[model samples]
Target chain A: MKTLVSYDIVEDKVRRKVFEACKDYGLTNVQYSLFFGDMTHNRREELFQRLRRIIGRQEGKVLICPVCDKDLRLSKAIEVSAGMPEEAAEAAVSYPGRSRKKARAG
Target chain B: MKTLVSYDIVEDKVRRKVFEACKDYGLTNVQYSLFFGDMTHNRREELFQRLRRIIGRQEGKVLICPVCDKDLRLSKAIEVSAGMPEEAAEAAVSYPGRSRKKARAG
Candidate 1:
């Protein structure tokens, strides 16, 4: 399932560690401090545990939520400045699952 | 339906406007740049259009996605530093819908 991870960490060092951990867990950083990716239930739980350990009752906060595929399909991304290249946007709107390559190319 | 909204804008003024707009739409700030709330399909679309206008091909980015209630049930929040009050957390874990009062009180 796809999961959404959003975090707010006051401490810079800990925040960086969490960011790296999320990346290692195969999530894509869609925005600063926001990540999303697909992973299995077991892996999601493992990631959650690892995150908990790293955060460890400090002064930061993390929220992890699963997002269904239907929701993802209905998701909207708008780039105000320099909207994505025409072809790239079309690819994304048409075949989101296959748009990664087009995105990379664009 | 519950919706997740995430934004990243280089311009401070525009970003602040977007933030205020989100609050006006009844979305709660979950993080500095992330907001989530429940709204109907029409309202979500209206908000999207308004956001698009505010952003207007500028150099900012926004993402909006619907989140199912079931997903919210499985969602997890961890606070590293000062965890929520025991009662508040328990309330959220037990009856999330009714935890708003407890959270506000705490």
Candidate 2:
């Protein structure tokens, strides 16, 4: 299964620490802090447990969610994977509508 | 009602265009390209439609995902919100374990 883990870290120090942790989990960098990766369902729970411990040590907090249908390999991953093209395609359409409103608001 | 929208845009031109759309939608900046904001369930479907139209014009593709709880305010939001702290706390612990393993693997 492919997991897109999005984490929220308050401190820059914490972000760096969390980034390292994500890299350890074999997740590829999609943005500055977000990650996309492949992990079996069984492995995901275990991975989440380990990530939790790291945050506990740093005195910081984070929210890690298992996002759906992200390309873990970044550019390459997007091309080869057909696990859920429909969902990704749907997002393509849904994303801009909100964006247009947001631009007008600001 | 809070929505976390994550978009994957292949082209930089497309990302910029999409970013504006997201800003227009009243979503706050949480990262370089990710957004966290509040929207009623009723508003969500409408928002998606608008975004799709925008993407169609761009000749690019994107993936917008409504992620789970992320404090849109960035800092103080985390404090005031008690809607889901346990999940965040759990992530704190889980993030690290995976990090440790990744460090070893690398």
Question: Best-fitting candidate, measured by lDDT?
Answer: 1
Worst 10 residues of 2 chain A by lDDT: A71-80
DockQ each: 0.53, 0.09
Q: Candidate 2, after superposition: displacement of residue B65 in Å?
A: 2.2
Candidate with the greatest TM-score versus the true structure: 1
Name the top DockQ candidate. Answer: 1
TM-score of every candidate relative to the true structure: 0.78, 0.43
> What's the CA error at residue B96 for candidate 2, in Å?
20
Q: After superposition, how far is residue A96 of candidate 2 from its true place, in Å?
A: 16
Q: Which stretches of candidate 2 lie over 4 Å from their true place?
A: A57-61, A67-106, B1-4, B7-63, B66-106
Residues A72-104 of candidate 2: C-alpha lDDT, one tens digit per residue:
111111111234365544433222223444433
Native A-B interface contacts kept, per candidate: 0.82, 0.01
Poorest 10 consecutive residues by lDDT, candidate 2 chain B:
B71-80
Query: A1-106 in candidate 1: lDDT tens per residue?
Result: 8898888888888899999999999999977788888988788778877877776655677778887877776677765446665544333322122355553453
Candidate 1, residues B33-83: lDDT per residue as tens digits? 889899887887788778777766567778788888777766766654466
